[model samples]
Structures are given as structure tokens and as C-alpha cells.
Target: MKAVLERKSEEALNNNSSIWRNKQFLLLIWGTSVSNLTFSIFTMALPIMIYELTRSAFAMGTMRAIEFLPNLLLAVFIGVLVDRFNRKKVLLSSVGLQMVMILTIIVLLLTSQLQLWHLYVLGFILYTSAYMFGNAYHSVLPLIVDKEQLTSANSVISFLYTFVGLIGPALAGMVLLVLNNIYGLTITAFGLLVLLLFISLLKLPFIKKEEDQKKTSMIEEMKEGWYSLIENKELWNLTIMVLLSNITSAATLSVFIFFALDVMNVIETKLGIILASTAIGGLVAATVAKKMTRWFTRGQLFIWSLAIQSLGYFLLFFSLDWYWLVAGMFCNGLSGGLMNIHYFTLRQETTPNHLLGRVAGTSSMLMKLAVPFAFFGVGALAEFIPVHFIFLGSAIGTALIIVYLIRTPVVYMR
Candidate 1:
């Protein structure tokens, strides 16, 4: 009788349109907005700072590789941990660890004792926590919202992210002008502190697993996640598409600072403005993403999104001016915003509650498997090859994958 009542209650919430009023949802979005805004500043500044410090492209590339290495090495295991542990504990612990890393970086920077190796080790740990937090973050949403509202909830989150992207670079650029990396990261540390408070206030719904399932070993749990991911054709195909696209993106983005600093000869402020302008496209796409999924079949939207990104890469490849590069980033942002909304919604809607952590982890690991290699290789190759050529290769690679997806009939598009 209690189970029936709970089901009816959930159904009512699903049918209603007051997701905006959801206290847990609102807190999560607001807190995320703060952290993302600050992190955007840190991301834009880090590569430039490294280049200024070491003057070595290889070092920069290595740092980028280190940042994402956790996605490949630890994401799956951490996903299992998120599934097995209390989510609130996971969120607080991850954010807390991230704050510590940021504070450490800031201290080193101020003392003029910061080194490349410090960035490497600290970056690895920070992003590892980030990935853990990310898995737990995504896993928690389904618990708080109705299944039917997944798209709406994810769209809202994506919009906040895109909105931050739109403004974050410019803000970071301004902060860089008045302050420095140390000051910028000070803001990030403060934001994480606030994020911890909001996380502590969350009252997530409880999920009960079967006694047998709970008793399974971690290895068995991981295998269960891998099998669950492969069993869903649409989800598996989407994961492959993202995986390939990330490789192309990594190739272009990893060297873009060199492209901008050397080829474009733009200053930091201008570069920030250029990157921030690109987010306009994403912001627009985020607003319309839910409607787009409804207007187009899931497969159709996926194709269109990737096509837009490929076009953006072509623009970058042929860029005659900074404006052209901005146009390229705009396309990338638009497609990314669209793809992520549907992709996340599908994952949330399709996967079982008990396995959300593991599946999210496994899928993320698979998506990022090639990224560190791409970053390191591009960094090494940039020493001999022109950065613009890398852009061309990315465009070509992206175009080929789109064709492959279209031609492959075994993968269902609808």
C-alpha cells in the first residue's frame, strides 16, 4: 500500500510542471552555476599560465593529458563507489578535495614556487575528484525528479553551463587583466566552499537495492555496468559518436592556445572575448534543445548536431580572421549543447536507478579513453606541424565520422 502511494505521488510530480520549484533541483543548479563560472576562468587561464611559465608546448600538452587521465583510469571505479556509497557524502568529499587542490595551487602561485610537476600531480587529483563529483551529480538528479522531466532538468543544467560559458571567458579575461591566476583561483576556492554548504542541505530520495545485488563484489558490479551499457543499442552508438567527436575536439582544442597566441596573435583579453562569443551559440541551442528533440527524431538531432560541429571545424580550418575562429567555436558550442541534453536525458531515462553511477562511470571512461593520447600527441606534433593543419585534420576526422554514422545501418537512428 505504501509503495502504491509513493508511485502515485511520483506520477503526480511527473505530470506537473513545477520542476522549477523543486527545492533540491534549484539548489543544485544555483550551486553549479557558481562553481562553473569560476572554473571557466581557471580553464581559460591555466594553459596560458603554463606556457608563460615553462615556455614548452610539450609541458602544456602533458598537463592537459594529466587533467583528463582520471577520466580514463578512475571514472569507472569511482562510478561504482558512487553507486555503493551515500551520494551526499560523495558530493561533499569530492568538492572538498577540489577546494583543497585549488587552495594549494593558489598558495604555490603566490609564493612563486609553482612548478609544472605540481600542476601535473595536483591537476590529476583535482579532476579525479571532479569526475567523481560529476558521476554522483548526474546520478542524483533522477532520484529527485520524475523520469518524464529528465529532459527539462538536463536542459536547465545545460543552459546554466552554456550561459556561464558565454560570460566566463570574458570575465576570466578581465580578471586576468586586473589580477592574476592566483586571484582567479581564489574565487574558485571560495565558490567551492559555498558549493559544499549547498550540498550539505540536499535531501535526496533513498534508493533500495536487492539484497543479492548489494552483496555482489565490486568487480561483478563493474561487469554488470559494462553489460548494461552495451545492451542498449542507441546509448552505445551515442557513446561511440561522443567518443570519436571528443578525439577530434581534443586535437583542435589542445593546440588552439598556440593557434591563437601565435597564428592569430591575439592578446589574452581578446582571446577570452573570442571564446566567450562562441558560447552565444550554445546558449541559444540550450534554450531550444528540448523543443528540438521533440521536433526531430533522436537520430536526426544527433546527425544535425554533429554536422554543425563539423561545419564549425571547417570554419576554423579556413579561418582568415579571429572572427572566423569565433564562428567555429560557436558552432562547436551549439552542437555540444544540443548533443549533451539528449544524451544525458537518454541515459537517465534508460538506465536502472541502482546502476546509474556505474553506467555513467563506464560510459564516461569509454568516451574519454582516447582523449589523453590525442592531447599528448597533438602537443608533441605541434612542435613540427602547423597548428592550422591540426584544425584541418580535426575537421576531416569529424566529417568522416558523421558519414560513418549515417552509412552504418546496424545502429538505429530513431
Candidate 2:
């Protein structure tokens, strides 16, 4: 009992130390918060826009597939660029490009001249820019805080993400309604808010990479990054785990709207509420993740959270009612939030600083490579098989991953 009490005291003290009190960390969090909110709103709004405009699930799925295409194609190269150049500049350029894309989208929508293809092109551009910025942001995080506070810092970031998710989707639905009522002012408003976020982010200091012993060609840099995974058995194992997790998540997300509208017979407004419930659950989980990490090993947390997520998916298969669907989504969100915090901290702590960007990008590419497959497969399956079976398959696949993790020691690394 005394030892447990002492350990808690130590953790509390560490959390309150000067490292956590840094102004930069606060600024980073605020900047990321703004970006996250805007991005989430854009994500939720885009699918609605596509669905409304084309009224085709295949079209929506195709657009989503395009959005992920950049992750599969450009991630590794972008990671190489991030490592070779200044990360801050890479981030700024990406944000600036995103702003341009959003502005173009708003203009097209306002002019009543927007076509489906226009959205496709803009969505691709936006996601490409997002991929670049995301890689830099993830890579730079470990540099901002001490190793001991990594889980706590990651938890706070994940908490902000969940908070944004909770607000952004509902706000997006509201904004769309407002736009319909006010004759397109809401899109302008959203664009202006995004511009403000980009402006505020300019105040952040540029993060400089530590000098390396040898600078190499772009191909060499990429090769070095690839070598980190190939040479380290532990990283390789974790990379595969992340890949499988992403597949399950993408499969579930791709078919979610179908399940909500068809199987559950939910209204759009209620759909937003259901999605928000998941975010609320995610917010709660993220808030407690730091505390939970003290009691459970990161591996233990990941495996258990995944198992819970699989159960959530299984529940979705059994329950076609609105309330049950919402409950399952909520549980899935909780597990996802915890898994994100744990996995991100693990990556930051274990990866070398010089290779951070490349490593992150490579990992992202690997994980997201399965997304297009999920999008296409879900769309294909929905035409023939019942949507419930898709959920069942996803649950079974996730359970298999958990079993694989249980047999492996991948999560035991610090």
C-alpha cells in the first residue's frame, strides 16, 4: 500500500514539473486544437456534401479513396522531405496549401458552379496537404516534451482531438443548416476560421533537426528510415499491429453511414448525435489514459483496448437499434482514443529524433495502405452482403489481431 501511494506521488510530481508547464507545449496544443477542429469539420462536411451532390455511395467511397490515396503514395516521399528540409517550413507550406484548397472549395460552392469532379480534385489536394502537415506534427511532438511525460503529453493531445471530434461534427451539421438558411454564409465563415488558425500557427517557433553524422540522398534517407523497421524486430512487429488496427478502423468507418441510415433507419441529425456520442466517450477515455497507463503496461493497454473494440464491433453486428449502435460506437471510440495515445507515445519514445519524420510517414503509409482496400471492399460488399456481416467480419478480423498480439511480445517495449 505504501509503495503504491509513493508511486502515485511520483507520477503526480512528474506531471507537474516544468516540462509540462512549458509555454511551447501550450501553444502547440492550442494550434493543434484549432487545426483539429477545422479538419474534423471538413471531414464530416465533405462526405455529406458528396452524398448530397452525387447521392451515390460508390461516389462517396471513391472520394474517400482519393483522400487516402495521398497517404499511400506520398507519405514516404513526404517523410523523406520532412527529414531533409526544415520541419517547420514543411508544416507551414502544407497548412498554406490546405488554406488555398479550402478557399477554392468555398468559392466554387458559392458560385453554384461546383461540380463533382471539382470536389474530387480539391479533396485530393486537401488530404495531400494534410498528410504532409500531420507527419511533421507527429514527428515534432517528442522534441517538445520529456520522455517521462510522453504518455501524459500524448493523452492531452488525444484529449483535444476527442474534444474537437465531439464538437466539430455537430457544429458542421449546424453550419450546413445555417448555410441553407442564410444562403451560403456558413461556408465563408468556416473558411475564415481556418485562415485564422493558419495565421495563429505562424507564431510557433521553427523546430530544427539535430545535426546528423552523415547527410544522404533522398533515396538513401528513405532507405535508412526503412532500415529502422527492417532491422528492429520490435518496431516491425508494432508496425504490423498498427497496420492491422488501421484496417479494422477503416473498414468500420467506411460502412458506418450505411449502417446508420439503412439498418438503424436514423435521421441525419441523429446520426450526428450518434457520432458525437463516440467522441464524448473518446474524450473521457483520453482524459483518463495517463492515469490508466500508470496501472497498465502499454502493451497491456493496447491489447485490452483492442479486445474491447472488437467486442464493440461484435455488438454492432447484433444490435440494429439506434441506441445499441450508439453504445457500440461509443465503446469503439473509447478504445480507439486509448490506443492512439499509447501507440503515439510508444513511437515517440522508441524512435530516433533524426529519423522521426521518415519513421512517422512510413508508418502512416503502411497503416493507410489498407484504407483504400477497406473503402472499396465495403462499397462492394454492401451491394451484395448484408451490412451487418461486414461489421461481423471486421470484428472477427480485429479479434484475430488481438490474438496475434497476445502471442507476441511487441507491446513490451518502452
Candidate 3:
């Protein structure tokens, strides 16, 4: 009795203390920052590599379309797996799988056997693993931190990653210009290796399951997740809102590489600068996100963020020069950064820790349902329409989504 009481007392104290003092949380952030840095670099390099290989805007869109398929197909099952199994092990395994895929990519590159098809297949596997890691990682955060600290914890994590983003793209550009895609990817592989080490050292508390409860089947578990999501009016509505928003984002982003290379006539280094500009907005959002919450409800933030994003897209629509495109990218990143912190915090705060994996997976699956088609459609359209028109279309779509959101009870949510 005394030991249990003392432990509880200690935990409460830790929970109330500063987030930086939490060793496990810090470790998680450090590891994730390294991985995000590499992923950012990979993101910059992959499109250029694909473009160089195929030189078709539609091909890049095809790659983007393929990347989201796993989310649509496998996320629900992966959610069940995360909730039932050890989350740390799931995270580690997912990271390891991605590393293997990256290594395979490196091998193909070195041997001069890399093909567009190879990227299509490997990218699917890699992103599937990334989805698994994301589910487990989201589930793990609630386990490690207190409820009151969620927003702040999320803010800190976002800030670090955005900071990484601020530099990672520019660095990737320089790396690509000077060395080659292989060297940039080699850095990514190394960061993942280091991430494995950090994750291994994390000592997460085990979740206690009720012994009297009967074991549920996987199908039943998935249904529970689905119900949990749809049953929540705010979450379900926001999920729909995000679904629309993602489509617009996908459409614009699908042809951005082409916009840079063909339309703007920029080289790798300048392209990186434009891409990295988004991170500056992200950095600003991360810095101010928590403070802004005190002044506005979460719902207000959502609407405003979407509004800002719409403005950003409109900027892109009129961007006759690279700097104008840079401005648009910054707004897009800023809105994304602002919304993500609140979005994740709200989900974690509302869902039971046990259901976090399932809910996250299902919601993600739902949000991603239309993205692949959007990618394909946008890719096809890029061949006919000017890229700026896609941005114009996306901006209009986002405005309509905002109108839809304004009519919902979502605006009333705190």
C-alpha cells in the first residue's frame, strides 16, 4: 500500500513538472527529430529522382498516389495490432522495415539497376511501415505524458521537427547538388540507425489489461475502433473536414516539382530554398501554437488555420515568380503545423489510451480514403492544365470546406 501510494505521488509530481525533465519524452523527441530530418531529406530527393528518371509530372503523381495506398488498405489492421501488441516493439519493427527498404533503394541506386517501378513498389512498403510507426508513436505519447501536458508536449515536438524541417530541405538541396541522391539517402539510412538506438533505450510503462475481460477477435476490435470514431461528433466531422483539406493539398503538391522544374526553371538548390521556406512558417506556428490556444478555442484555430491555408494556395495561384511560390508554401506549412498540434492533442485527450491506436488508425484511414484518387486525378490533370490552375482549384476547394466547417458544431468545440 505504501509503495503504490509513493509511486502514484511521484508520478503526479512528474506529470506536473516541466516536460523537458521527462527523460523518456525527451528521448522520444530526440529520436523522432533525427528520423524526421532524414525523412525531410528523402522527401526532397525522391521527387527529383523520379522526375529525372521519368521526367513526367504524371509519373510523380503516380508515385504520390501509390504512397497513400497502404494507409487506405492497411491502417485499420495495423491499429488493431498496435493496441494488442507492445507499442515500442511495433515502432522499432516499423522503423527497421523502413530502413531495410531504404537500404534496398541504396543498393539499387549503386548498382545502376534502379527503375521507376522499383520506387513505386518500395515506396508502398516504406510508407506502410511509416503508417505503423505513426500509429504506435501516437499511442505511446499518452502513455508517457500527463493529459494536461499534451498540448505543450505536442508543441515542443512540433517545434523541434519544424526546426529540423527549416534546415533539412535546404541541406538536402545542397547535398543533391554537390554529392548525389545516393549520398543524401545514405544520410537518411544513418539517421534511422541512430533512431533505432534511441528507441531501444526507451523504458515505457506497460499497459495493464483487465484479466476478467474476454479476448476480442481482430475484426471485432476493428469495429470497436470504427464505432469509437464515428460515435464522436466532433472527431468524425473534423475527420471529414481534413479529408477534403488533404485532397486539395495532394492536388497542389502533386505537380509542385513540375512547377519548380518546368515552369519556374529553378535548379536543385533554389528548389530546396523554396521547399525549405515552408518550414519557416512551420517554425512560427510551432512557436506560437500553445500561446494562441489561450486566446482562441481549438475550433477557432481550425477555421483560421484553414483560412490561412486558403490564402496560401491563392498566393500560389498568382505566383509568377519563385518568391511568390515560397510565400504560398510558407502559409501551407504554417497552417499544417498549427492544426496538427491541436488535432493530435484533441484526439489523444478525448480517446482512451487503450483505444488510441485504433482510433488514430481508423481516422487516418478515413482521412486518406480519397488521397490516392486525388493524386491520380491531379497527375492526369497536370498534363493538360497549367499547374497554377490546380492551386486556384485547391484554394476554391479549401474555401468551400471552410464554409462546410462553419456550418458544423465543430466550431463550438473548445
Candidate 4:
């Protein structure tokens, strides 16, 4: 009993400590913001580039499949490396590889040698490297920041994400409208170059791996992560939440290009706006998340956020007009914003420092395993069913999860 109280005291002290004064944390967040900008723009631009070229929903799903395939395959190994090595080096190398790959793409575009296959290969590399970076970054946060401040820090991070979403996609749309694919890509390349500069200045606290840790077989390490996640009820439940959420979300959105272009008749040039609209709700939620989190239990926030977010689909899936679409997006973003803060912080708070990487990697790989299947399934199914019907299935899936959460201990966890 005394031990638990000491641990709580330590955690309270850590949380109340000022991370705002930490130079390293600030630099990390700033550098991450830059990298997020690069990826955000790239994410919005990549599908547009492919859809414009192929005009096939299968092609888009396949590209996404390629992206996540690498994430699924390499995530475990990346987790092992993060635990076994200096996280800063992993982050730097991953960011550098992505920059070089994006640069290669820019060159290909400028030389008129760009092709669909080229995007497939580069997208795979970009996403895989991103997962590597993410695994390392997530692991490193607790090392540098106070445990108590994680929610606040992550809320800020979520805001940056949505803020980029708000600006990046709209910018991509505007850029796509006025410029060509080459320009959209060149801008991405430039953003990555800036990321390289910021990453060079970034640093983190040192974490030592025990000699026995080095002696552990790679398979053993991977097995450890699986245990860490599956044995923990909270972790397992959160994993299930994202897994189900993503499957349905994937099914509904796998044919978004067709939905936007054919169903809504949105111009190719304005697709970015449609994509950016989702970020608006996220930004608002993020802005108030820290205060709001304090006002409610994490469980309450998660439940209510999911409810509010679910309400947006009526407008998101049904709205034909751009303005209504934006409104739906705002609702989507709000719940999304709440979901991210609690989800990530919950993992960081619970996972042991040494196991954070593997647990994150294994859980990510498992949860996202359902994503590609959903994408492909939605793509193929849309051929037979009207694209609009996909949302009906998605809404039903969400309600099922909500029902499970309400009936379980998950919603009552502090």
C-alpha cells in the first residue's frame, strides 16, 4: 500500500513539473510539427496523384495496402531496434531515408519519368520509415517529458496534427488546382528537407539497454511485446477499440475518391478541401482537450467523444454540398481529437519503458492488420453496392463498439 502511494506521489510530481521549460521537448515538438507538415501534405497529395492517373478505386486501395504492408512487416523489427538502440539515431535515420526517397520522387517528376509503380515503391518506403520513426518517437517521449504532462503534450501534438490537416490538405487542394503533380511533390520534398534540418538539432535523454537485453533473441523480444499488450486488459481493450474503429472507417473511406468525384461531383482540384474539412473538428477538440480532459475521466471523454463524432456521419456520408460536408468533418474531427489524446497517452502511461516500443509495434501491427482488408473489401464491394451504403455499415460497427464499451469496465477505468 505504501509502495503504491509512493509511486502515485512520484507520478504526481512528474506531471506537475514544467515540461514547458525543457528545450529538448520544445525542439522535438517543433521538429515533429515540420515532419508532420511534410507527411500531411504528402498524404493528401498521394491519393489525388494516383486517382487522377488511374481513376481506379482498386489502385488507391492497393497503394494504401502497400503502405500499411511495410508498416505491418517492419513494425516488430523496428520496435526491437528502438528498445535496443539510441532512439535519436533511429529517428534521424528514418527521417533521412524518407527525405532521400521523397527527393528521388521529385527528380523523377521533374524529369517526366514518374510512373504509377514509382509511387507504389516510394509510398511503401515512406510509410515504413514513418512507422520506424513513430515507434522510436513514442518510446522517447516518456524519457524526456514528465509522465503527468504526457496528456498535455499529446494534446498539443494532436493539435499540431489537426492544424496541419486543416492547412495542409487545403493547401494541397489549392496547389493542385493551380499547379501540377510535380509542384505538389516538389513542395513535399522541400518540407522534408526542412525536417532534416530540424531533426539534426533534436535530442533526447539516454536510456540504457541491459546486457541481457542485448542477448535476448529477436523472436523473444517480439514475443515480449505481444505479452505486454495482450495480458493487460486496458491495453487489449484500447487495441480492440482502434482495430474495430479502423476496420469500419476503412470500409467507408476506401472509395472516398469515387465518393467525392462521382457521388458529390466535387472537382478534382477541390478534393483537398474535402480532405481538409475533417481536420477542422480535430483542431477545435485539440484546442480545448487539455482543459476538457481535466473536467472528465478519460473514460467519460472517450465515450462522449465517440458519441459526438458518430453524430457527424449523418452529414459526412449523406451531405452532397461542400458546406455540409465541412460540418460533418468538424464533428468527425472533434471525436478524433479526443480519441487520439486518450488513446496514445493511455498506452504510454501503462506500458513499461523498456517494452514501450515492442508493445506499440505489436499492437499497431495487429490493430492495423484489419485496415488493408477493409480497404480492399470496400473497394471491391463498391463495385456491387452503391458507395453511400458503406457508411451504414460503418455506423453500425461504431455502435456495436460503443455498446461493448458501455457494458464493460473500459469506460470506468481512470
Candidate 5:
């Protein structure tokens, strides 16, 4: 009898038009926005700070690889943990841990004890917590928002994310120039503290799982999740596309700053503005995504999104001029923003709740599994070849990926 009413309630929520007023959903968006805005600043500054301290492109790429490597190693366990525990508790804990790490780093920086190795160890731990938080975050979305309201919820989140990205980097650059990396990170850490408070206030609906399913061994639970993700035709198609695209993006971006430094002679302070330009395009895309998705078929939108990313990167192969490079980033950001919102909605709408954390984690793991390798590979290759040449190769690789996806009959389109 309770299950019957629960189903009826879910159906009504799906048909309702007031998702914007969902307090829990809004809090979720606010929490992520707070973190993302600060993260953009800290991470953008981290790499540049590394470059300043060590002057090694390899070191910077290695830091990025540190951020990614956890996904490969811990994704399976993270999915299980999110599903087994109270996700809200897990999320708060993760964010809290992240804040501790950031604050510790700030302390280390001020004391002058920070070193390259310190960053490596800190990044590994910080990103591991972040990955866990991400699984819970994804799981929380479908729990709070109606299935039909996903697009609207996602659009707002996406807009907040990209709009902040558009501004955060530029702000970080100015901050870095005026005060230093340490001061900039202090501000970033403060934002995380606020985010922690917001997460605590969120009122999420409980998601129940069967007793028998709960009794399964962790390995078995992971296998169940993996199988479910791969077996879904649409999920598999989307995951495969992202996995391929991430390979080239990782490779290209690994060396992008080096190219700017070596070829374009771009100053570190001004580079923040350049990085921020991508956000402008992404922010614009988030603004229009709801309208655009309405006009286009899901499958077509997916393919077009990938094509735009490819076009954007391809142009970067020869963009020595700063404006030319900004134009390229704009296209890439626009498509990236579109695909992210659509992908979130599609996954939530399609996948079952029991498997949401697992599939989301697994897909994320698979998508990023090759990224570390690409970062390391591009970093090494840049020593022998021109960075722009590597960008060209990445462009070619992205184009090939697009062609394959276009021909393979994307099954995920709405």
C-alpha cells in the first residue's frame, strides 16, 4: 500500500511544473555551485603554481594525473559506499574532508613547507574524497528532482557552474598576480566552508533498497552495478562516446598551457582570462540548452555537441593569437556545457535508482581511466615535439572519434 502511494506521488511530481521551488534541489545546486566556483580558482592556480615552483610541464601534468588516477582505482568502491550508506552523510563528510585538505594546504603554503611531493600526496587524497562526493552527488539528484524536471534542474545547475567558471579563472588570475597562490587558496577554502553548511541544510528524500540486495558482498554489488551500466544500450553508447572524447581532450589540454607559454608567450596572470573565456561559451550554452534540446532530437544534439568540441580543438592547432585561441575554447565550452546537462538528464531519466551511483561512478571511471595516460603521454611527447603539433594530433584524434560516433548510430538521443 505504501509502495503504491509512493509511485503515485512520484508520478504527480513528474508531471508538476514547479520543480524550481524544490528546496532540496535548490540547495543541492547551491552546494555544487559554491564548490565549483572555488575549485575553479584553486585548481587553476595549483597548476600554475606548480609550474612556477618547478617549471616542469611534466610535473603539472602529473598533478592532473593525480587528480584523475583515483577514478581508475577507487571508482568501484565509491559507488558501493554511496549506495550502502546515508548519501547525505557521506556527501557532507566528503566536503568536510576536502575543506580540511584545502585549509591544510593553505597552512603549508604560508609556512613555506609546501613542495611538489606535498601537492602530489594532497591531490591524491583530495581527489579521492571528491570522487566519493561526486557519486553521492549524482545519486542525490534523481532522489530530489522529478524525472521530468531533470532538464530544468540541470540547466540551472549547468548555468551556475559555467557562469562561475567564466568568472572564476579570471578572478583567480588577478588574485594570483596581486597577492599570491596562498592568498587565492585562502579564499577558495572559505567557499568550501560555506558549501559545507549548505549541504547540511539540504532535505533529501530517503531512497530504500531491498534487504536481500543489501546483504550481498561488496564485490557482487559492484558487479551488479557494472553489468547494469554496460547492458543499457543508451548508457553504454554515451559512456563510450565520453571515454573516447576524454582521451583526446586530456592529451590536448595537458600541453595547452605549455603551448601558450612556449609559442604564444602568454603571461601567467593573463592566462586566467584566457581560461575564463571557455566559460563564457559554456555559460551561454547552458542558458540556451533547454530551448535547444526542445528543438533538436536527443541523438542529433549529442552528435552535434561532440562535433563542436572537435571543431573547437582542431582550430587550436594553429591559434597563436590569443583571440583565435579564445574563439576555439568558446566552441569547445559551448558543446561541453550542452552535453553535460543533457547527459545528466538522460542518465537520471533512464537508469534505475539502485544502480544510479554505480553506473555514474563506473561511467566516470571508464571515461577518465585513459586520461592520466594521455596527460603523461602528452607531457612526455611535448619534450620532443612542438606542443602545437601535439594539439593537431589531438584534433585529428577527436575528429576520428566524432566520425565513429556519428556512423555508429547513437542510441541515446531523445
Candidate 6:
């Protein structure tokens, strides 16, 4: 027992070293911040844009469905590609594709030839590329940092994402107002500028992979990833947890815009403020997650966060006033941030470094596979059921996950 304890302590020390603080990690973080900022802007703005153009909830749902479709269709293949190639190259190439796609969309929008189909096509392409890039990014994280620091490293990433999210939506709202008065060319131009800067500033130092020279076909590589996940009990359990969490989260997101616009009657400007408030709550939660994890077991953390979010969802369901809804969103955001830190860290720590990309991809694929269906279902349900009941249902789904966790052996191992 003493020997085992000592070994664990040593591993922890090694993980906390400055050697894990490489220049590559810093560059990657900066690049991610820039890219996510732009991504968040689009995430918040596009829904509003579609609503304004069509005023149809179905249209908004379809747009979301298009964005998540790639995760369902190409996730496994993307995972295989990430594992087989130079991950850095894969990352850069995916970002480059996004840059081109965004530029094209901007041009079309500026030319005033932007049809709804154009928006759908462009959004699909961008999100597809993002899914691929995200798979590579998450997979490579374990390679960059030591195993013990996985939690800390994930916390850092989540904190950055939360920070960007906080500013991105609010900025998008302001930009929308500014661009609405202009020729619309200015918004496109500014978006192009942000994309260029993000791509240009992205610099990754070379690092050797464990399977650097191993030649494997994509099909074989994909099979290996699948085998790994299926064989690993911990990984399989974690994947299940992720899938349940994602379903609830996606449902909430699918209906959130309608709630803000139709239910709360919030205009564009105040809507931005509310978005910022939620993001700020996430940022605050992420900032303290590391400390929280020190006191709680991973299982405990997961259960508590889910419970908090479930409660928040219930509040949202009952909230009639704008301020009350915003408060509920804020609570949900905090739970989201905490969950992000825990989920990513758990995945990184449990998976082997060589299979990180494939595992990450496979796991992402599973979680996201349900997203399109969730969006469609929620959208359709909203047409029939009251929006409040949808929120209540999401909360119930989240609660079910907690109950499953309590009964399963998933928590004790990690």
C-alpha cells in the first residue's frame, strides 16, 4: 500500500512540472481562444439571423441539425484520420478549410446573394470542419500534458473557452446592431479579418508521437479505435455518461433561442447581455473547478454537477420573467463549465496516449450522434407541447443519468 501510494504521488509530481508547460500548449491555447471566439459568435448569431430571416422555429432547428450532422456522419472517420496523420497537420488543415468556408460565406452575404440554402450549406461545412478539428484537438491534449495534470489542463482549456464564450456572444450582439445599419459588408469583412488572424497566429511546435512511423490504413486504424473503446470498461462507461449529458444539453440548447425570443420577449441587445451573463457564470465555475475537484471524488463531482444543472433546468421551466430565465441559465452555465472540466480530464487520464485521437473521436461521435435527433425532436415537441414542459423533460433526463450513475460501477474506478 505504501509503495502504491508513493508511486501515485510521484506521478502527480511529474505531471505538475513546467516541462508540461511547453510552448506548443500555449500556442494551441491561444489559437483555440481565437477560433472559439469566432465560433461562439456564429453559434449565437446564426440562430438569431435565421429567426429574423424566416421567423420559423423549424428553420432554426434545421440549421442546428445541419451543423451537428457531420458529427454523426464523419466522426469515426475523422477520428481515424487524426490518429493516422500528423495531428498538428490535421489540425491546421481543418482550420484552413474553415477559414476558406467562412470567407466564402462572408462574400456571399456581402453580395446580398445569401439565400437560406447558402446559409445552411456554409454552416454545415464550417461545423463539419469544426467537429473534425475538435476531435483532433481533444485527442492531442493528452499527448501534450502528463497524465496526472489532465484535470488541471482540462480546467485551463475550459476556463479559456468560458472566457471566450462570455465575450463572444455579447460582442456578436453589438456587432449585429452595428452591421445592421451598415451595408452588411462590414460584418463580413470583420469576420474575415478575425479568421485570418486566428490562422496566422497559430503555431505548433513539433512533437514525436509514440506511433510516429507506424503505417496503418484508415480502416484498420478505425477498427483499432473501436476495439479499444469496446474492450475498456472505464472508457465505455464514460462514453455512456457523455452521451446522456450531451442529449440533455443539446435539447436545452435547441429550445433556448425560442425561449429567449418568443417566451421571454427579449430583443437582440438584451439577449446578448443574457448570453454574456450565462457565459460569465461558466467562467466562474471553471475557474474554481480545480479546487473543487481536490475536495470531491470524480464520481461525486459528476453527480453533483448534474444535479445542479437539473435543478437549474427545472428553474428555467418555471421561470416566467426574463430575469428569472437568465438566472436559471446562469446556473446551468456554471454546471456546464464544471462538467466540461471533469469530463475531458476523465477521458484524457483513462485513455492510452497512442489511441487518444481515435478514442476522442469515437467518444465524440457517440455523444454527438444523438444531437441531430435531439434538435429535431425538441423543435417538433415545442410546436406541440409548451416550451416549459420541454425544459422539464430535459431536467428529468439529466436526473435519470444521475440515477444511472449511482447504480453503475462507473464512479468507483476513477
Higher-ranked by lDDT: 3 or 4? 3
Candidate 4: C-alpha RMSD to true structure equals 4.3
Q: What is the C-alpha lDDT of each candidate?
A: 0.84, 0.75, 0.87, 0.77, 0.80, 0.74
Number of the top lDDT candidate: 3
lDDT per residue as tens, model 6, 98-188: 7677667667656767678877988888887778788878877765565666677777888888787667766766766676513332443
Locate the minimum summed-lDDT window of 10 residues in model 4: 1-10
User: How much does candidate 1 score in TM-score?
Assistant: 0.84
Tens-place lDDT digits, model 2, residues 157-183: 888877876777667677666665123
Q: How far does residue 275 in candidate 4 sit from its true spot (Å)?
A: 4.3
List ranges where model 6 is wrong by over 4 Å: 1-21, 38-61, 106-122, 176-216, 256-274, 318-323, 382-386
Question: How are the candidates ranked when ordered by lDDT, highest leading?
Answer: 3, 1, 5, 4, 2, 6
Name the candidate, 3 or 4, with the larger TM-score value.
3
Clash totals in order: 0, 0, 0, 2, 3, 0
Q: Give the runs in model 2 whose Cα sits over 4 Å from its true position.
A: 1-20, 39-61, 105-118, 179-214, 264-270, 382-386
Cα displacement (Å) at residue 206, model 1: 1.0
Candidate 2 C-alpha error for residue 176, in Å: 3.7
How close to the true structure is residue 280 of candidate 2, measured as C-alpha lDDT?
A: 76
* lDDT winner, 3 or 5: 3
Q: How much lDDT does candidate 2 score? A: 0.75
Q: Tell me how far the alpha carbon of residue 341 in candidate 6 is from the true structure, in angstroms, after superposition.
A: 1.4
Between candidates 4 and 6, which one is better according to TM-score? 4
TM-score result, candidate 2: 0.82
In candidate 1, position 49 carries an lDDT of 77
Better of 1 and 6 by TM-score: 1
Q: On residues 178-202, what C-alpha lDDT tens digit does candidate 4 reach at each position?
A: 8776677677777766766766787
